[model samples]
Target: MVLGALGVCALVLGWRALDLQVLQHDFLARQGDLRNLRTEPLAAHRGVITDRANRPLAVSTPVTTLWANPREVLAAREQWVKLSNNPVLNSRTLSQRVEANAGREFIYLARHLAPEQAQQVLDLRVPGIYALTEYRRYYPAGEVTSHLVGFTNIDDVGQEGIELSMDNRLRGTPGRKKVVRDLHGRVIQDIAVLEEAHPGSNVTLSIDLRLQYLAYRELLAAVTRNRAAGGSAVVLDARTGEVLAMVNQPAYNPNNRSGVQTAALRNRAITDVFEPGSTIKPLTVAAALESGLVSVNSTVDTRPGTIRVANKTIRDHRNYGVIDITTVLTKSSNVGTTKLALAMEDHALPAFMEHFGLGTATGIPFPGESDGMLPIRSRWRDIETAALSYGYGVSVTALQLARAYAVIANGGIKVPLSLEKVDQPPQGERIISAEHASALVSMLETVISAEGTARRAKVPGYRVAGKTGTVHKLTAAGYADDRYVALFAGIAPAEDPRIVTVVVVDDPQGQDYYGGLVAAPVFGSIMAGVLRTLNIEPEQPVGTYAGVIDREGRL
Candidate 1:
């Protein structure tokens, strides 16, 4: 009877084993997976950003994140004591944090560690500490291109400037795969991928690093010399409307995150707006020529250098008397520009400005681009009209002014500005007749000649045309009593236009606050450097100077 009972028990045990091994094999396997299997994140690299010359502006480099399973860490107190005491991890505070979150499944011990640093941390072999592969964004150009290239956040997402503007294209999709981790949470076994990672597409911006450095150096010098609040300088390809360099003073390093002010992050060239002052005179002249109401030789009388309209008086630095349109621009005459603005209907000047992209965003792909304020036709008082002509009662970003000048430089086509490198020149809208544009260009050339407002803007080998603007900064109490914004916008090689440059110096504290004195020199230096760096042929031959030096090197 005892033997029979033993046989029955054995048969029952055999049957139970067969049922579990075959009938519920999937369930058994799932149970086994719960403890050892993990869906590990496969990090994808963020795409690199390069300048037009393929020089790396921003790139991603491999990094590691040290994490821990707090529960496991606490369970192994002896190992935990060693890990906590490992000076690199900071013993006392680490011990406290682990104790406080002992129930937690995961915690970050250190983030964004270099390979060497990560290896140093891993060498401790604490029970729960693990290093996960990740990436960190790095900017090669540092503060030089900070405002233009921008930066990314801890999660590798763009936060400002071009990085933010093109975030979608610059961000990669993180993938996942199954993996078996050892008791210490180290990945030990390879498993099937759940999804493949897709890296972001690379971007080639229109920015030329060579030109960018040049602009930065000159702008920094001018701002420091003048003791200005801040400054911005922009360089654009006049033919294709590509922004080659956009720089601002008081910039911050993107690679460093400590003590950075919000104001320093602003890309002033595209976002900040100021009254353009006399810089608008060239556009007003171009409008008059476009309307066929005046020739390039159209003359305005300004015997006293002042004009009165609607209880307000507009005046120039001195009496320009009677001057032709070209001389009017060269002198930056407020009275002459007022007459030109009022020559037509009240809305004509504003309409012309709108067509030139004034008081409007330049349509750049940057964030926080301001569309400068412009009044509607209904608000056009005589004083307002006069002020608008001379760039008051209106505001524009430096980029907008650069684009408007580029349109004139390119012979009347208003091409869409591009931040990315464009393969082909865009077919543009004709904002003005080519004849009118040419006439305006010829008139602007006078501004760089002797006796003009911006004579300092001239380059010896290349003809330059630009306008000077000194506008009072608007305050809560109205125009400021002392603050002023000095501006210079110019086109180079007037015979065959190539680049447009705009320099803005905000509230220069130096005794010389005029645009001609404070900003024109910056424009000249940037233009000359850019022209030479691009290998653009000089408009003036080697011996084009009127007087030759004697053998003693005396002129």
Candidate 2:
């Protein structure tokens, strides 16, 4: 009888627990009904950019943004009033801030807010205020890859660089949550969902940091030494068209994007145009040789240091009368080169210029790439033809000029330049004969030797072949005084050419305009640094080879 009484007590207790929980469950849930109705954004992370070895170049870090539900604040007006009394609040007049945001369902307090500031706001215990998460892009290389990595706005939207070009791919759709809520202001469960957030894919670049730094330091030193307004450098692998380095002076840090002048942000390599000057002579010579108008040994009469065509007189930079075609390049004899270009058919000259990749965009992956102006044949006056022969009256961007030399370095085949790696470059169409390219290389090599104008560009262990150009800057009115573009385009280890590096120094203020003194030294210095960084063994021992070296097998 006693055991039965204990069992009866246990059953009674169980019944009472069930009565409170199961029988009254609906009533309790009703009290917390709308709690589950809160809507939250599901954001996807942006992709990281890395080098081939997965070394970070661009990265993203999570940052917080503060916002508010105006309706909730309105309901808790007493708490909001207490919040309004804070002195550090942004609004000068709390009444105006409350009024502007009074009727709205949502209002953004601030974005990418500092955590300490956010904590202060949270400590106020304002009813509707909340924080959301977002990603901010950071370029680790700083100004080093600023031109390539670009930047984005606070909204996680791309405004420039790879971010702008790949905005569609880099930016992901944000997901949202919806739910049903009871009158008691508590959500029950999720009701519907769509547009799932997906993270962006990784983007890899062809740029090598080692080679990039090499070019950067060398070019920076050149501009400082020459007292130049600006400088640009490019290194392209001749075999694959892989762009190893794209360096520029006056580079801006992507980290600080405020109040930046447009000029400082410009990519001089692809955007700025200048007269190509004497660097253009090789193309003219190639056309002449290809068309059988001249041979490497053929001579031209460069008499009196000048030649008259129509009303204009073309003058050699300095006279070397009756020089061979090779000697024309060695001495930079403009009169001989012009005479050679004039010998070709007018139509063929333009065709050859087009073949050399002038007056076209190089199709580099960058924003605002200018397709430099190449005047039509109809615009050519007689003087224009002769002047064009020596690189004047025609504006070409640094990219177009570099690609033109790349064609020569690539064994007369024109391969499209790429910022990204290629499994294989499509078989490029032959633009010039191999024989003509070989002849041009021979002439160009002399330019880096003691007999040539660009002797300063010679590398001790390497046989370097290239052209030096010094052109006058054009003013709105016409050509101006004392301003010049000094440029050098060359391939190193000429016996087995690899990277074709081009260096352009704009408007040096110093006493030198000759590319030898201004741009060629920059080229030599950059190439040497690149070789050392890449662990490319020198062709000679320390202080062994001074100039030309016969083609030798590498270790």
For candidate 1, what is the lDDT?
Answer: 0.88
Best by lDDT: 1
As for candidate 1, its clashing pairs are none
What is the per-residue lDDT of model 1 for residues 57-84, given as tens digits with 9 covering 90 to 100?
9999989898888888777778755655
TM-score quality measure for candidate 1: 0.93
- What are the lDDT figures for the candidates, one per model? 0.88, 0.77
Model 1 segments more than 4 A misplaced: 1-31, 542-555
